[model samples]
Structure formats: structure tokens, C-alpha cells
Target chain A: MMDKIIRDNYQRETKIIDAVYPRTYRDSTIVHSDRLQCVYDVFTYTGDRLNDEGVKMNLMFLHGSGMNRFIWDYYVAHLLDYKLGAAINKIVTLDQVTHGDSSVLNRGKLGVGYDWSDGARDACKVAQKEFYSGLEDNSDDIINIVVGHSMGGFQAMCCGVLLPSLFDFIVTIEPVAYSPNVPNNSNVTVLPPKFFKAIASKVEDEFKNEAEYDKFMHERSFFTKTHPEIFERFKETERINMEDGSIRTKMERRQEMLCYMTLHPTSYWLLDGAKHIKVPVVSLVGGIATWAPKENQQVLQKSIPNYTVDVVPQGDHLMNIEMPDEMLKRLSVHFTKFAKEYQSKNYDNSNKSVARREEIFEEIYKETERNRVKNGKPVLAKL
Target chain B: MMDKIIRDNYQRETKIIDAVYPRTYRDSTIVHSDRLQCVYDVFTYTGDRLNDEGVKMNLMFLHGSGMNRFIWDYYVAHLLDYKLGAAINKIVTLDQVTHGDSSVLNRGKLGVGYDWSDGARDACKVAQKEFYSGLEDNSDDIINIVVGHSMGGFQAMCCGVLLPSLFDFIVTIEPVAYSPNVPNNSNVTVLPPKFFKAIASKVEDEFKNEAEYDKFMHERSFFTKTHPEIFERFKETERINMEDGSIRTKMERRQEMLCYMTLHPTSYWLLDGAKHIKVPVVSLVGGIATWAPKENQQVLQKSIPNYTVDVVPQGDHLMNIEMPDEMLKRLSVHFTKFAKEYQSKNYDNSNKSVARREEIFEEIYKETERNRVKNGKPVLAKL
Candidate 1:
């Protein structure tokens, strides 16, 4: 009955995202433009497709870790049916490589190992082909907007910063930054890495069928608190039949562990990206999320130029899911204004504005450090 | 029959450590040298009491978070029976101020909501009275050594660093440092802070008797892996029957959460202490603990003048519990050597030795940074 309810929601065709990018595993030679296929769903506006205006605006949504493009399917349906009437031309959602129906070229060699940089490069490849390549002489007239959550958020920010000309407008929600300045409420205890390896070991590679998998999932809550329908949609979208005549998850456990261990360390990449990015950013924060909240955004915004924030009041870390209406309401205003100004060629995409914003962020950091001293709080150490 | 089996081991009196120290708490005025009592168990040496050479080496064991001094009781029993063999004079194990039978001076205000710095201060106060003040003016002749695990390990490092005059020798096992430079492999996912609060709220503060609590605990694992007798000893020593009607855990749940939150953020205090500390430090690593291992110790030692490490093979983060014999074996060698040298007045306690050690540490950091750059690994951000 549950599977029927979920399957009924996603009856549309799932398109594969074909792209090739360079990849490297630990202690091995790097592979350049290695073939990769990710899956995505695109939503076109009801009436805006044939709009008389020459300027265009489209959104590309990126999902976080342990989740696929199915996360945005609910938002797309809700947005089209009720929100954003005819404000946008198109909306694109893609599963990250190794997630959902995604596959890589060197199957065995690239098994379950990929870095955040790889994810960023892959997203860039997909965006370049789908959004930019076929553009006519009016390339500057288009705004390839990007929205991402968690891991995707980190990757999206990287895309916006690293390849500035590719992605125009960016919105990153609760991007993970492990810097000391970021207020993380996660467990600080040294739980053994083997504990996760053990958890992975416990997962059986083969299940009799979807029914057995469903029954097993019914006994356990995936996350602490989440809507039942969302989890059901996940199982519907991500679970698949294996070639060995059994049902199993699309992504492997060993790969997930590798992803965590390899990329979990914090150094200076995110901050470096933020330091040089030419565009403005809107960082969304879950109001009550102590783990990764507005405070972390404040740290990012202080360092990054023109990085503003929107907080969903009373929302948890799953802000996009828990408070979709609030998220859309906050985002639509910015989208409408951006589209209107860009359409009229009135928006300034100049270096002067970027310079001014940099000064503003500098001043903010200085003020924060001053007040921290005045209030007897410890001043955050910078790199 | 089960109770008989459990209680058969810990059949000694649990002594209360009485001392007075200044304290401040939430929503209360500062109080000076407030009288407090901490629980402890002292184990004297075998056969050899007074050494022929008139040398002395005393041991004080400090337990980790959510644990009483009963942890060292196992080591003491094992060491006295076999390992130490009268090389040391006395071994005393004390509960941290907010744990075990310790009574806070400001009872209502400090109900388990103290910071790590407070833990350090309280520990110093206990050491001053119990170890130092009890002795005659031969302070330089006698070695006041301390061994601690987890939070206690951190505090022991702090004691060795901050109050270098008091604490002569220190062995810190798996100390927690939340700095960016300190590589930690714990989960970086944002879990709700309320989860711990909710867990605390569910705790039945008042239990009918020891049997009920014992039955309750039987369902849970104390540490990752521990000997049955050690856990059983914890129940006997830390669990107590309250006068009015019920039995309860010595440490409150709220206190545990506060300790985690207030002290979790990274700062310059430990680094500042490390820069100017006078005593030698030995940091023990569970060879397999990726969370905070030798790499992190290298960072700490770079700033500290005299810091070395001992790695326990095939051990987890809980070094004291998992490899008690190895921990003691490594420590006993150092203790015996230090005692003999001190007796002969031949141990190097010169400024030149400290200076030379600092240079060695500086070279290690430089070499590590050079190798990191050479291998294309990101250099860890310095505070």
C-alpha cells in the first residue's frame, strides 16, 4: 500500500545526465574527463516558455548527501501547482554522481570513491552542456541560477566561485563547513571510524525483494524526525533491483564510508572559494538548527562578499522539506527582482559592486571582532 | 546471585576528598574557597614502603567524563598485584568535582553545569590539598605525577601546562581538542541539541534502590568495550542510595550536556598554555583511533616544549579500558626511571633542556608542513 502511494507520485520519465570529468582515487593516477551519468528531472513553466521577454532565468537544484534528486520532486510539484505561477522558465534537479540511477565510467576503479571537488567539477560539466553550450550571442542575458542543500550546497558554492562565468545566481542552504568558526552541534566524541565500517558490514548486500527491504525499513527510523511521505518517496526513488535478482540500495556502503572519511576534514578550500567568488549568494539557514544554523552563515557571510542569509523561522536542518512554503516565499522575491532587472539590462554585473561588497564584509568582520572583545567573548582565530 | 557476583570485587571503602576552593556558577554570585568534597580510593604499594634511597613517586588518577574514579581502581588492583611492584609510594584515584560522591560548594547553582576550565580548577584544588600540602617542604624532591583519560586527559594536559609548578609529570590519554589543526574523525552531521536534553529529561532522577538502577544499566553498554568486572565496579562505587527514598547516579544528565556544549568550541587557551609550560608531557594514543591520534598530538607538541607520544597497538579510543596493562607498562617504565634519577639528583630539569625540546618540536611541525605541501595536501590552518 505504501509503495503504491509512492510509485503513484513519481510516474514521469527519469532522464539520465551524461557528463565526463577528470577523477582520481587515493594513491593512483588521475583519470581525465572520465564518463559519468547522473539522473535528473526538469520542470518547465506552464506559460513562461513562450514569454515575449528575451532574458531567461532557470533553477538547477542539487540535493545533499544520502539523498537523491527525488528530494526536489515534491518541491517542483508544489511550486508548479501553487507557488511561482509563471515567474521562471525552467527548473532542473540532478542526482549527484554515485547517487540514485547515476553511474561512472570506470565502474570497479571508481566504485564508491569520489571527493567534493569531483562533485563540483561534475556539476559544472552538466551545467555547461545543458545551460550554456547551445546559447546564442545573448549569453550575458541569461542567468543560470543554482540552488543546493548540504553537500550539494557546498558543491554549488564551489561552482559559483570557481567557474564564476558559468553560474550567475546562487543559493546555498546550510552548507557544511567544519572550520572552528562554524558552530557545529554534532557529536565531538571520538567514536571509532570502525564503528561506521561495522555498520556497513552489517548491511546485507542482497535482499529478497522490495517487500523485505520495506519491512526492514519499517522497523527503523532513517533520521530522527522526518515526514513519512518523504522517506517513502526516497525508498521509491532510490531503491532498485540488482542484476543478481535481489532488491538493494543504489549506492554502496563502502563508498559512503569513503566519502565521509576522505572529505570530512576541514582545511581552507571553502573559505578560499568564498574569498574570490565574484557573485552574490543567498545562504538559507534553519532557524532552530543548532547543529548548522545562522551563526555559521554569519561566519561565512562575514568572510564572503555580498553573502546574505534567509532563515526559515522554527524550521529544522531539513528547511527545504519542513518549511517549503517559507523557503519559496523567501526565494521568489529575490528571483522576481533579479529576473526583472536582468531582463531590462539594468542589473550591474561590474567589478565595482564586487569591490564595495568586499569592503562591507571586511567592516563587518572588524566590528564582530571588536564587539567580541567588548563583551568578553573569545575572538575567533582566523587562518 | 547476580548481585553477589558483581559485589564480590569492589569491597573497599570509598574515601571522600574534602577541600575548599573559590567557585562561580550560573545565576549565582562568586564564592571564595567554598568547601567541597570529592570521592576517591587510595591504593598503597606492596611490600616496599620506604625506599632504601629515600626516593618518592606518587600517583593520582583522574577519570574521564560521565565516569567516576572507579576506572583506575581496576588498573590499581592490577598494577599493585603485578606491574608497579613497590616502585611507587601511593596511588590515589579521585572523582571530578561534578562526578561521583563529590559535593559542589554552591550546590544549587553548580548542579553539573560547569565548564572544562572549572573541571581543571577543581582538579588543581584537590591536588593542592591531597598531594602537595600534606607533604613537608621537600616538594622539589617528591614527584607529583598524574594520569587521566579523555576530559581528565585534557585537564591533565592543562594542569601540566597552566599550573606547571604543581603538576610535575603528566600522561594524557586521548585528549579531546576541537581545533581545526586537530584532526577529528567524529560525525560532522548536525544532530539536534535537544536530543541530549530530551534524553536527560527521560532520565528517572529518583530510583528506588541499587537493584533497579543495576537492572536498568544491564540493558546499556558503559563504554565502547570494557571488562565486565570494571563496569560492575562502577555500579558499586558510583551508584549510591539517597537518604529520603531513592538511589541515583552521582552525576546528573544536564551537567553532562553543559560540559559538552560549553567546552566543545576551539580556542587558544590550551595552545597558550602549551607555549609556556615547564613540565614534560606524554600523550598516549590508541594506535587505531583516527579521531584524535598521533597526527593531532604532533600539532599539540609543536607548541608544547616537552611532549612525546606512546601508541597502543590495536587499541580503540578508550585506551585505559581497552589496554590497561599496556598503559601501565609504558607508564611504569617512565615512573621508575624518573624516580631513580630524582633520587640520584641527576634528572635534567634545566631551561636548556626545555629550549632544546622546543626546537625539536618546531622542526617536526616544519617538516610536516613541507611534506604536506610537497604531497599536495592542504596545510592545516593555524590559529
Candidate 2:
């Protein structure tokens, strides 16, 4: 059902860009010292323009461990239509150094250790060189927003800290920015080794048959409660059949583990950088008591003084998919407010014309109204 | 940071129960009926267990039009942990009628007007009944909670209204339960229809190719922005290759319209039913300012006199997934308070041996400590 909705509601174009270096190794020299070569996949809405500017918010999504940028596809669709017939900006998703279609590290070697900071640096390099380049050219006219979820959220924070001048705003959903030496006594931890071993064994057994692995992961992963249409759609895109009729995740498992093991200690770089960030920062925390400890929120609020945290009620780690509407709402408010403030501050008294601004607003209103009628909701229309 | 942590710590178990029906509709009998059938799929941590005598929360996930139950897998995984760790009673998920493995209405006939109330009725008969039966059998020992998102959320409200006795609590994330009728004289009505057609046409063009269609939906759907992981997963599960080499959604498109257009009018059956509900209700409204009109929340709160409406700051319709941890926190506070009150009233006076209860508490404490250690955190040598 969701597929048809997407078909009936959204249009996207995905293009894979080749990275300069095909692989990253612990000892490998940087191919481009100033930039990291990586694949950029942009999902643009070929629908009616939501704004008079015909501009969209460009999100450079960063994937979590063992995953790729593809994780965000589901959420982007629902956001296409705002509750009041408002449309959101476009999204550009990318794979981190060793995940997804991007170049593998150590020539595809499994479990090679990589510095967590380097990954952040690489992400910033991508944003500045690839994502921001376009935005920079249109900085005066575009309303750009940066959105990241989970690890992607972390990367987004890194980007905000590193390139604060480039983005109009930053939004992180359940960002994992744990500081080292923080008290862990009351924190939730992983189960025993035996439990993990059991899980590993099960995974291995399933790996012997790709389809079984797919089924196993499908059932076991945190997606069991998802709507079936979504679940089925995800399974189709995320699972790849192996030669033996078993399905293996497109992402390598060991690399996934490496990403998991790597952690960024509360770095002075991020902390110092965040202090200087000029744009509004909205952090969304899921209320899954287990995933996010109360202390974490306290620590974050304390660490990033300028940050505004919104705790999503009844949300978990995967809050974006579980609650896209909520996430978007928060984002919309922040973006709208930011855009308004930005325009006000940057407005030039001599160059600005009240009549011109009103004219523009009128045009946008007409366009929005037209969209509502064509979409079949002539009632409750927004302009 | 969360991505790495999840990679290191996350493990899940998924199960699918077949032959679940959301609701049944007999064209000759009634325009909208109150029974639905659905498959009940559950996901949980392998070692996690719920409190033996607490209220259990059942999440009845309803997919949007053309979607199935798979969209909620991620939510289930996260909510399952709540049920296990927080002493939640149980979690139940099902495919809506005409979707997933459930029997389709009209045997794949198109353009069936599936009233939203009918969908709600289906939930009442199938999922809600089973949940009530479980709670009723354990009424002296357990409580019941309901969580729903998007269309599923609307069904949750219907269930709350129709079967007020079944749930002790209800949470709806960005539920489009009612949209105020716009005045015809409003300027919004004057917009050109071509604009709406353009938006609709763009959506239609997404289905030109199978892979593109899948990608289009995966990228634009609500899940895309919030729960990217599950979004990817759903895209994989619910798409089929078409004869024209385009991917056709496995779900019937007309069913999607039915889910939206078939909403039950806020009639006496529903409005009066709300007045009779005995449990606390929490409606998590997304503050996107676009999707959910302020009037909708007002109407819901007015209808359910005992309800508590919380506006998720900067949240969209799918607030649950967008900010899972935050949502969890809000829900936990409510549930925990309810649980504590219930326990104090009912179990406080029971003359169970203090020594026995103490021993049980100690055992639980020890288990929790063990779990902390297993998760790779430093543990005090002596608890």
C-alpha cells in the first residue's frame, strides 16, 4: 500500500557517484587531502513545488554502522506532503567511508579498525565538497536544512560543528554523542557474551541460507512491528540473494562490527566547534527509556548549551521511521522559524520592497491552494 | 554514536503469526462493519521478560493506503523492549484487512470504499478482541495499553471509542482523525486545479519503472525521514515486478483511498463512546504546523474528556518513530504512574511474605546487574 502511495505521490531520481579512492585502509594515504571521494545519491521530489523559490532543503544523510544512506528512503516519502499540504525540501543521502556503495576500507578487509574521528572528518569533507558546494552557490536564495538520524545524526552534528557557516540549520534525531568516563553504572548495557554468541550462531546459521538470513533478520531486527507494506518494501530493497539461495546483507557484517566498536570520546573539537555554531540546532531524543538514559539528555543539554532538545514521546532508537510525522513536525517548526529569522536579519532596508514580498507571498499562497485542489483535498486547504 | 552502540548491543527476535485479519466487510450487510482480522507478529529480546502481573501494551499498527503491517517492524522491536523491561504486559501487531497476508476485501477488486470506521471495526473485532481477552483473563494481574501511528493511529482511536473497556491507555501519533471542513469562500478555494494535478501527476510518474517506483516510495514515504532502517526493510518486502518492467505495489491502490476516505464521521457512536472510556488517553500531536491542524487536537481532546494531549515539539505525524526515546519517556511516565497506583491499591495490602518479595526483588536486581556487565560496561565487584 505504501508503495502505491509513493508511486502515486512521489518521484525520485537516484544517481551513484564514484569516489576517487575505491578503498580506505588504516595505513592508506589520503587520496584527496582536502576531500573524500564518495558516492552521492540524491532523492529529489519531482512534484509540485512547495515554495515559490522552487528550492528544497538538502539533507546529507549519514548512515549508521554497517548500513548505507538507503536507510532513509522510507521517511523521506511521508514528509513530501506536510500535514497542511506543505511540502518539504529534497534529501541527499550518502554512504560513509566503508559502508554501502561507497569504497570499502582495507580493500574490503573485514574488521579493520578505523578511527572514529576520521569518519567524521570524511563526512564533513563530503558535505563541504559535494553537498555544500551547490548550496553555497545558491546560499543567498536557498533555504537549506541539514537532517541526520542516529549515526547520521552524529555525523550531522559533526558537520554542523565543522561547517556551521554552510548550513542554515541542523537537526539530529537520537544522536549518539556519548562522552567517555561518563558514569555507566545506571546505564543500560548489552546482554552477556553467551547471549550474543547465541545471536551470532543464529545469524551464522541463517547466513548458510541467504533467504533464511533475510527472514531471520526481518523477524529479529527492530522492524517486526512495522506496517507490512513497509516491511515488505524494505525487505525487497535491503536483501540480496546469495549464490547459494541464501540472502546476505549487502553490507559486510565484519565492517558493520568495526563501525559498532568504534566510538568517539567527548572530543574537544566537536565541543569547541559547537560553541561557535550560529544556526539553530534541534536535537530529537527518543523516549525509549532503555536506549536513551535520562543522564544522556542532561549531559547533552549541558554540553551543547545552544541546543534545543525535544524528547519524542513513546519513541525508540529508530524514531525516524517509527514516527516520521513527529520528527518532521519538529523539523518544520525549527526550519520555518529559522528561515523567518534569517530573512529578517539579512533583509536590506533599501533593497527590500514590502509590495514585492507581499506579491511573492501571494504567489506562493496561490500555488499551495492549487496543489490542494489537485490533490483532491479541496477542504482544509493551506495557502 | 547511537549507531555504533546499537551495532554492538542490538539483538532481536521476530515472529509472524499467520491468518490474522484486521476487519471484515460484507457489502450486502453494512457500509461499514466493526470487525477486522489480522496476523499478530511480535518481536522481542530473547531473554527479556515482562512483569508477570502488570498491564501489557498492544501496538496495533495500521499502514497507510497501499501499505501493510510491515511498516511497523521497527516500532515493534523497540516497543517490545518496553514491554519486557518496563513490565509491559504484551505487544500485538497485525496486517490491516486487504493487505499483507490477510484476506483482501472484494477479492482484489479495485475502488472499494473502505471506511476508516470499518478499518477501526476490524481492529476491534480481531486485534482488540484478542488483546482484551488477554487483559480480561489477567485483569486482576495486568493492564492494557494501545499505540498506533498514522492510519493505524486512527484505528487506535476507533478502537478506544468502540472498545473503551479494552485499553487502560491509548497514544496516537499524528492521527488525522478529523480535518475541519474548509469554508468555500476561503481564498484557498480559488487556486487553480492544475497545481494539484501537477502534484498528483508527479506522484503518478513515480510508478513508471518498478525499481524507480520502489525507490520513489522508499525515499518519499513518511518512514524515510524517521525510521530509515525499517524504511529500507519495508521497501524490500512489499514491492513486485510489473509486466512493464516497472515495480507495482503489491498492495491494492484503491484500498489506500478507502483507508483515508472511509473515516467514520464523528457521530454519536464514536463521540459518545469517547465519553465512556475509563482509561487515560494520550494523544501525541506533531507540531509540524502543516499535517495536523490545531483544531483536530482540540476536537480530540474535547471528545475524550479524560484525555491528555501532548504536543510533541517539532514533531510530524509519525512522532513515535521520529523521537522514540522521548515518546518512550512520556509513555513510561504515564504507564509507570498508572502501574504504581494500581499496585498500591491492589497489591499493597496483600500479606505476601516480606521475605519472599524481598528475595524476588533481590533476584531481579542481580539479573539487572548481570545484564549491565554483559553489555560491556564496568561493574562494581560487589553490588
Question: Which regions in candidate 1 have their CA more than 4 angstroms from the true location?
Answer: A1-20, A24-35, A42-54, A81-87, A104-107, A111-113, A133-139, A179-212, A215-229, A242-246, A264-267, A293-295, A341-383, B1-383
Question: lDDT, candidate 2, residue B268?
Answer: 21
The regions of model 2 sitting more than 4 angstroms off are A1-11, A16-37, A52-55, A83-89, A103-111, A129-138, A179-206, A227-230, A266-272, A347-383, B1-383
Cα lDDT for residue A357, candidate 2? 40
True contacts kept of each: 0.00, 0.16
Model 2 residue B364 CA deviation (Å) reads 38
Candidate 2 chain A — worst ten consecutive residues by lDDT sum? A26-35
- Against the native complex, each candidate's DockQ, computed on alpha carbons, is 0.01, 0.06
- At residue B320, candidate 1 shows an lDDT of 81
What's the lDDT for candidate 1? 0.55
Considering only chain A, what is the TM-score of each predicted structure? 0.71, 0.72
| The TM-score obtained for chain B of candidate 1 when compared with the true chain B | 0.71
lDDT of 2 by residue, A1-383 (tens): 44554565555555544332212221222111112345655555566656643344555666655456655666566565453222344566777655655543222222243434445545544544444343332334444566776666666766554334456677888876553322244332334455345434333222667556556656766555554544565556555666767665555553454343343222333443344444677888887734545654565567564689887888787767666667667766766666666566542222224465445434543443443343233344321
